[model samples]
Target chain A: MGLSHQSIINMQPDVQLVAVCDSTRFVLDMLEKYTGVRVYNNLSKMLQSEDLDAVIIATPSKFHGPMVRECLEHNLHVFCEKPYCLDVTEGERLAELAKQKGLVNQVGYHYRFVGAFQEVKRLLDIGAIGDVAHIKAEAYGPVVLRPSGSSWRNQRSEGGGCLYDYAAHPLNLVNWYFGMPESVGGTVMNKIFSADSEDEIYATLRFGSGLSGQLSVNWSDESYRRMTTKISISGTRGRIYADRQECQVYLRDGGNLPDGYLSGWNVRYTTELTPEVWAYVRGEEYSAQLDYFVQRIKAKEMDNINSFTSALQTDRLMRMLIDDSEREPIAASGDYQPLAKGNSSWWQRLTNAS
Target chain B: MDKVLFGDNQFFGVNHMSEEKARAQSMRFRDTQAMIDVLDMAYEAGIKTFMCTTHERIGEVCDYFRKHADRYPDYRFYPGMPYAHKYANAVTDHGIVGAIKRFLPNDGLMDAVVRGGSAVAKKEIDGIATLLIDAEMKMFEGLSTPVIFLQNVVTDFLLGLGMKDAFRVFADHVKTRYNAEPGFFSMNMPRLLDVLEEVGVENPIICSNINKIGFRMCGGVDLYQQILAQRQFRPVAMSVLASGAIPPREAIEYVCQLPKIESIVFGASSRGNIRQTKALIDEFMAVRQD
Candidate 1:
């Protein structure tokens, strides 16, 4: 992720990558040697040595809270990678601190920049799919096919496993569209490969006005070459389905449909929906997100997309998922017998007769 | 470049339009024999160039081609370098230095390692880039790789970094080291053409999305059409079918009518689809030439 930021920063005409700090000596050495960028092992030393307008944090989840706080203390703008902070309270406090300090803060919820997903948001804003009743968010990947040695990603305390790594993308998109869920229930964090953390997560969420949604994520699915995030919404007037590549909408007859769309199925591919960026990497969304952050910093704007407050909402929802998953299952109060167990003798007699 | 090149996306479960079909294709081609069978189909159908990624599985394909050299006398490979996921997974399993060590070609292992260190010490970005490129090209050693391509992921990445010199470095290294023409795959063809021109790569081969719907084509269809008409680069069209979104006839017709398309690359699992697509390209190209 740091490499991604470095590449984008190098490309942006207004920005200059003065220094990079990482714990890995090899990475630091390679970057310093190949790119001629100053390298540091300690964040404090880099912070003190370099005069910078802002900092981009692409470290582990556990390090984000302290790193972001320290940067905010230095009165610098910050662009941190997604899964903003593990702890909701700390995320809230940091959000407040950034707000009070009048510093620009953005999180790397990059799906917001994807053209197809953005088209979905626009259509929903226009009520093209009128009164969304339910939405299903899904993300699947082949990250952890088998149990491997411990890494920050596989550890619950550091990278937060699939819940934070894989699920957060679609979950962030959900929050972006719906704001926040009123409550969450039926949450399950199941482990398919990793021993320390959950590789799959499922949850049911309730939004305001009886709007509900489901979140399903699995990182151990070997069927996908990479992470695939998708969202489908069913509304009273229409239904919409979207993934990274395209968005498909189905509007019922006699509904207020947006222009360029009919009262039937409509499909928009990412190519047509996406506007050309100044530069591109793996996807336009990546460079777009960073460009947005850089522009906001230049403008000294406080309100922006994917702000710390918006990320905090995602963190709070993740916390709700964790708490919901931890609750004990409802237990039967009275003696209850299984029908199969009670009727086994009769079934055996019928089998003997046969 | 071949007028029509075979692609390897279907064998690797990379359907951009639908995941379900990707998964099914992935399951169908899990074995090397399944892939070899399709390659045979493509070969027998007179499509000689196999434009493929340097996935680990492709190493097996290379080995099979080497072992059975007589079967594919005119087979040519246009390998795209530094399969990003392979490197990403390698970096995960083995840290930076270890991953570099693991992928370095074994023949000149010690020398490459030393050069890697010295390249760092001298702050020579080109040396390191060439070293990595050599590592990626190891699988295609001893094979006829007339046109080696830098995959879009890295090409566009360097483009994003505004590293025009890197393009020159790659082109020079590919020309001098391997005696192959350097091709670039990018999502943004117009911008890449401008950059390549700045780097002084004359009439370079560039592969990009060039379908009717403009699937994955950066700068939209109008900009691409304008560039195709005005630019002086060899445009090899990929995703010409837009992941099956456009019908074969329309897709082929769209690209065939374009001014400067040097080639069209498409992937299919069956001999029928392969034959049908090849026939369409042939008919359209013939018609357009007339």
Candidate 2:
């Protein structure tokens, strides 16, 4: 949305700038300078006075549901930033009401619009990578706290912690790609960056397609910004390597490449968006989300971008991540008991480790 | 010499071997100087060797015993048989199975005989005999003092695969294997003595325990009287205070009333318990008319 906002301003179709609302006045002033739009401390006062087509909510987690609900009730199309609400039930109810009232809604997970990701999806659709195995993506931010070191994110009641804040983005991408995971399990340790939010999270997600993947997200890690996310795939034909920043594909050739050769022998594919995201913003096009909402308003169809079902499924995945991590470690047993049945083999005993 | 003395005639004394307590007390195993204090009290009360029942790392305990070999120059330290539980009960800090392997040198006949559910095969009986002979040679080869085989009778319950009769058969086999130079076997004082007689065993045997909670060694009064008349009886009085008729301070008084009693192995689960029992025994001797 950041780049798209600049693109829309550059398009300049007699679009007179209106008021902008931000929880922080500093960000509001910055947005005013960037877009030449007047800033409003309160959204309700701005909405009451100005004839607005839509209201974009880019506030903290706790306000997302209420802001979206108010926007819908006021008969304005809504564009909500990612992780529409910490509570999926609230997001679901708002979505249902929007559908009933025929309102437009768009959630701000902009990765689905990135051309590289779309290209990967296109390959999967065309069977470039055999069966759709699984897709994995990750994103992280600094310790989940404001500069003041005190905020709603630290309070459990506010629902703005890491499980809901940073992890929710990757989880949303997972849901968007591979449906819902069948059973999720792994450890979540509160290692270095100790807050109400989990400092370190390790999770294994098992999808119905029999493909499983592991994800690790933590603020307590040594590097300030070392984001590691990769999509590993396996099928009848070949595999694709969608690394953290680059896209590369390896194929089985008939005595084509030498054993140790990687540079020339190995086929390589690269994206232009590695250095900056502007190449993605310009060359690759996303449905102008605000325009999509306007189209939804004209067509009398409910926008399902942040629909209740989608958000609830994402929330379930988040709860699973938290649940698996907080479980206790097992210890050694003093005496052995007879196995449940007479399973006298070593393989039977190994199952107990699970 | 009483050819094949019925028991080893050895008294149990303080050996820092109860690893269960050692674990409950962790790296603090010997910290309270508990074993030393118990040894001092038992020594003053004329008790000789204190056999430790379990050990943390038997090698470390053996090392400890070897280092202090000079202090116990006159007394015997009979390390009890070490048997691995198929399922570990509790592990010491050192490691679980490593602790059991460390005490392999001390395992006696009964330790070898008990395997959780498999019946005592002829092979198992032969195995027990071999292990006992090996442990015996290892213990007594250099030392002049005889090393007795210490067997806890309760271990038979753990070998549920074998019935009492199977154990008897295994016992007879062990006796026959070691007939020329019988290894001493300790009993808890209430097993059917007929089995011991049936096997024609004369290896020195000590009934290390007396009957507890009023169950006679042999069933009927006639059988008890008849057996009491036929051969000599020895009792290592245990659980005398269970009825509450006997006080903790009257251990010696409590043992004399029991028929054919020779020695009293007082309850000493703790340092304080051992001290109290030793004091009671000393007090009883002071008042003895003999």
Candidate 3:
């Protein structure tokens, strides 16, 4: 992601790569040489020294809260990576701090900038699918294969698990569409990897008046590389499908689809879905996201799609689901029960089924 | 342990023939308490064993039995693993990582985590498979789980892929790891029996669809009958009503009359249905004994 940001920033004349920081000097030297950007060994020293309009934090997740707090205090527009922090309270506090400071703040959830998903949100806004009943969000990849590996991502203490590291992308996407869910349940921490953290997460969510959702993420799949996140929204009228590079829209006859897209299933490739770009990288998402963050800072815009508060909601939701799943198994839910079962006649079966 | 083991398909929505009925059954027992109500009905009617798919709700049911162990001292759970759709759902919702999470152990979790990590690193097939079984067995802690069955989706999928050794591994692990007998559900009983026999899983308990109407009775009904008569393995009749197409009396009578049939498993949501089927089974079994 840092490399991708460099590729994006290379094309943005307005956003200069002034300085970078890391404890590892070898990698830092390589990066400094490649981008001709100055390097600092410490974050605090770099913040005090660099003359910058904004700072992009690509640090480990456990430090996101403190780093963001530091950046806001420095009055710099901030762009931290996918997860803002390990838990909810820190995320909420950071978001509040950003709000009070009147600063432009964003989390690096790049999926929201994907062209295909943007179209998905657009179609949903126009009632293209009509009253989504449930959304199945899945992301699979062969990121971690072997049991023996040591990385921050494999540690639960570092806020590294499939849930926060990989599933956070799709969770953010769901938050984009549905806001805060009413309740989140189902397990989200089964370890397929030998890492301290889980390699998979499965969660069922309830959102706004009858809107249900399923979130699944797995990094142990041998088939995919990196990840392929796909969401299928089953709605009253039809369904919408979105992946990283392509989208499929299946809608009823009355939707406001323009041009060649008909009432039935319409397949769209990235070329058709993507907006015209001034700079193209491997994916337009990185370029678009960085551009949006920089532009917002220039315009003095405190509000943005991937704002701190939105990331906080997603962080809170993920924390809630994990906590709920880890709770003791209930002997009884004690929800309302059916009054009585009539005779198992064919007519009664039909009525009961409906 | 009981002759009539209750199935869990009725608690979770799983009707092979009709989505409408599956949904109805699903909605009817949406509340785990509703499931408890039906399960209580079955227990009170003297059906003490539950031959169940290890769906998420079964964990809840296991919790109930464990908490009130004294209340239902004789109750037993025959856990069926790889509740296939749950895995599919978990994979979809959590991806491979999240799906693995669904099977995470609440206890000895770190040991399992380390083993899972090392197993992946070592690519030890048996290690990973056993870890998964441990995860599935986590919910039945301190409860009676005398028999553990492999769900047919995995059984048949492995069979088709000619992964017959998986059956042996599961059987051995069930006996050695959990001190329980292993059961296998198959779509084709005759073929599964042959595979089990070849794998040296001797006299194993096997469940498959078997009824007079040949409702999903794969590998030919006569072949199943011939095996039932001649084979030494235990047979548990399932899908006996063919998803309620056949009447309860006829289904019970046919299965009971079959040679060497050890038990029958069925799912129903009502007390009347539970008692009605139990009475028919008791009547026919009494006659068979005579």
Candidate 2 DockQ category? incorrect
Worst 10 residues of 2 chain A by lDDT: A274-283
lDDT by residue for model 2 (A1-354), tens? 232343332232333446666555544544454335576788787888889866667666678888888888888777677667667677778877777776677776555554444445555566654565555555554443222243555444576655665567667756766668899875554545445556556678888756776666654443222233345555444555553234455545433332332422222222232221111122222334444444555676663554545666777788677677767645457865655756656777678556
Q: For residue A113, give model 1's deviation from the true position in Å.
A: 1.8
Show model 2 residue runs off by greater than 4 Å. A1-16, A25-36, A132-137, A140-148, A152-157, A222-229, A252-309, A327-346, A349-354, B1-290
lDDT of 2 at B88: 26
Report how far off residue B144 is in candidate 3 (Å): 69
Where does candidate 3 stray beyond 4 Å? A33-35, A254-260, A330-354, B1-290
Q: Could you give candidate 3's per-residue lDDT for residues A15-102 as a string of tens digits?
A: 6677777765544654554335688889899989988778888866888888888888898889989787776787888888888888
Identify the leading candidate in terms of DockQ. Answer: 1
Each candidate's DockQ: 0.36, 0.00, 0.01
Model 2 compared with the native: what TM-score? 0.44
Q: Arrange candidates by lDDT, descending.
A: 1, 3, 2
TM-score of predicted chain B, candidate 3 = 0.92
lDDT of 1 by residue, B1-290 (tens): 77999999999988876666777998899999999999999988999999999999999999999998888888999999878997877777566666766765556668786878776556567767888898888888888999999999888877765567789999999999999999999987988999899879999999998988766676788999999888788999999987877889988998998898889999999999999999999988887752
Q: List, residue by residue over A206-267, the lDDT tens digit for candidate 1.
A: 99897999999999997677889999999988999999888999999896778889888999
TM-score of each: 0.85, 0.44, 0.52
lDDT per residue for candidate 3 within B1-290, as digits (tens), equals 57788988877766644434566887788788899989899999999998877777778878788888899978888999976655654553444544665565546667787877765455455666788898788788898889999987677655643457778889999999889999988766777788899989999899888887664555467777898888899989888886665778887898899887788898888899889998888888777842
